[model samples]
Target: MGKLLTVFTPTYNRAYCLERCYQSLLRQSNRNFIWMIIDDGSTDDTKQLVEKWIEEDLIEIKYVWQKNQGMHGAHNTAYKLIKTELNVCIDSDDYMSDDAVEKITDFWMRNGSNNVSGLIGLDADLNDNIIGTKMPENLKKSTLFNLYNKYGVTGDKKLIYRTELTRSFPYPLFDNEKYVGLAYKYYLLDTKFEMLLMNEVICYVEYLPDGSSKNMYKQYVNNPKGFAFYRKELMKLPFVGKKFKFKQAIHYVSSSFIQKNRAFIVESPERYLTVLAIPFGLILYLYITSLVLHK
Candidate 1:
């Protein structure tokens, strides 16, 4: 009876670029969605700006402020607060397409069901070029894991999830680390459900210089435990092949070294693989550390 979708954005001090996302929402042909902002302790004028937008009353907006926690923590908050049947995350620096809301709602209304997790849509760059290859036209549904590893789909795709599934596997926060792979929850979902593919570009993304994707070596150094936890989980996924598991084990070993976790071998979900990965992982750890140091 109410809005069927919640388009939530989790942000930090991204006030300068956040307006691009806000303006995009205002242009949506379908307004059957609400915009929820999780302000992850921005020191900038984010709160004041959002307040001004709220006063405009142009779109349904819900804003919540929390102390600085990383992106995953803000996601945890968004999942907790979203009350819609479906939800999607459009990052602070990314904006939706003009007809994105229309495409999503119309597609879901016709084809959505509880049997599937939700839909996977495309993301493009500012130049209107698809960020990577498009989804396989013949493939109607696949787990997000399979979409890349098996089906050869490339690039960052937009995910619209049922709120309940996302809330099921909340990411664990480390003592001082701010990053855990966002894919932790998504991988968990893959164990139970596959996502329907929609080859339309629903979101446009611009990778900012300060964005997390650009600073992975630093993130690896700072968030080793978090990275280890994510890799361990990925190693345990039932559907992936040994090659995939081996690769994850390599990362798990690297992260374990970074965090200096002595029990990584014993604690590993795949102990044998972890042992084999140790040499490569140590090299990777040194490589990452060197990159960070040189920077």
Candidate 2:
């Protein structure tokens, strides 16, 4: 009965670029959605701008502000507040196609079921080309993990999650670490249920030089606690294969060393694998250190 979808945007110090996302929402042919902005302690005029839009009353808006905690923390706040049946994330720098909401609601109303976790949609660039290969034409539903590992899907994609299911996997915030892989939640969700596959393009993306995607090396060194948590979680997934677990163990070793946690091998979910990866992890640790120092 309430709004069917909440398009939550987590932003920090991007008042200049936030308006484009606002304008795109304003143009939506279907406005059966709420625009919730998680303002991660922006010192800029982000709050003031969102207030002005609230006054305009053109769309539903819910804005919350908290001390800077990066994207994962912002997501933590949004999920706690969202009570809608469905939800999706449109980054502060990205916008949706005008009919994106219309298409999502229409499709879900016709086909959505609680048995599935959510829907998977496509993300495209500003030029309107799909960012990755389209969803497999014959596959009606698939886990997010299988889509990549089994079907060879690549590149960034848009995910629309069931609000409750998304809320079930809150990302663990580590001390002194503000960056965690957002996909950490998605991968966990993959272990529970499959998502309905939809080939429709839902949103547009443009990676900024300062965005996490562009600056992952720094994130790797600075957020070792968060990265280690992500890898440890992935290692525990029951559906993951040994090869995947070995790769995760390697990264886990690397992150643990960065965090100065020396007993990582003994504590690993796959202990023997972690022991095997120790040498490679040492090399990776040095490589990461050199990269950070080189920068």
Say which candidate scores most in lDDT. Answer: 1
Which ten residues in a row are the worst by lDDT in model 1? 251-260
**Clashes in model 1: which pairs?**
none
lDDT of each: 0.94, 0.93
TM-score of each: 0.99, 0.98
Model 1 vs. true fold: TM: 0.99
Error of 2 at 113 (Å): 0.4
For 1-295, candidate 1 gives per-residue lDDT tens digits of 6999999999999999999999999999989999999999999999999999999999999999999889999999999999999999999999999999999999999889999999999999999999989999999999999999888878899999999888999989889889999999998999889999899999999999989999888998999989999999998888888999999998999998888899999999999999999999999988989899999
The true-versus-predicted C-alpha distance at residue 87 of model 2, in Å, is: 0.3
Q: Candidate 2, TM-score vs. the true structure?
A: 0.98
Off by over 4 Å in 1: none
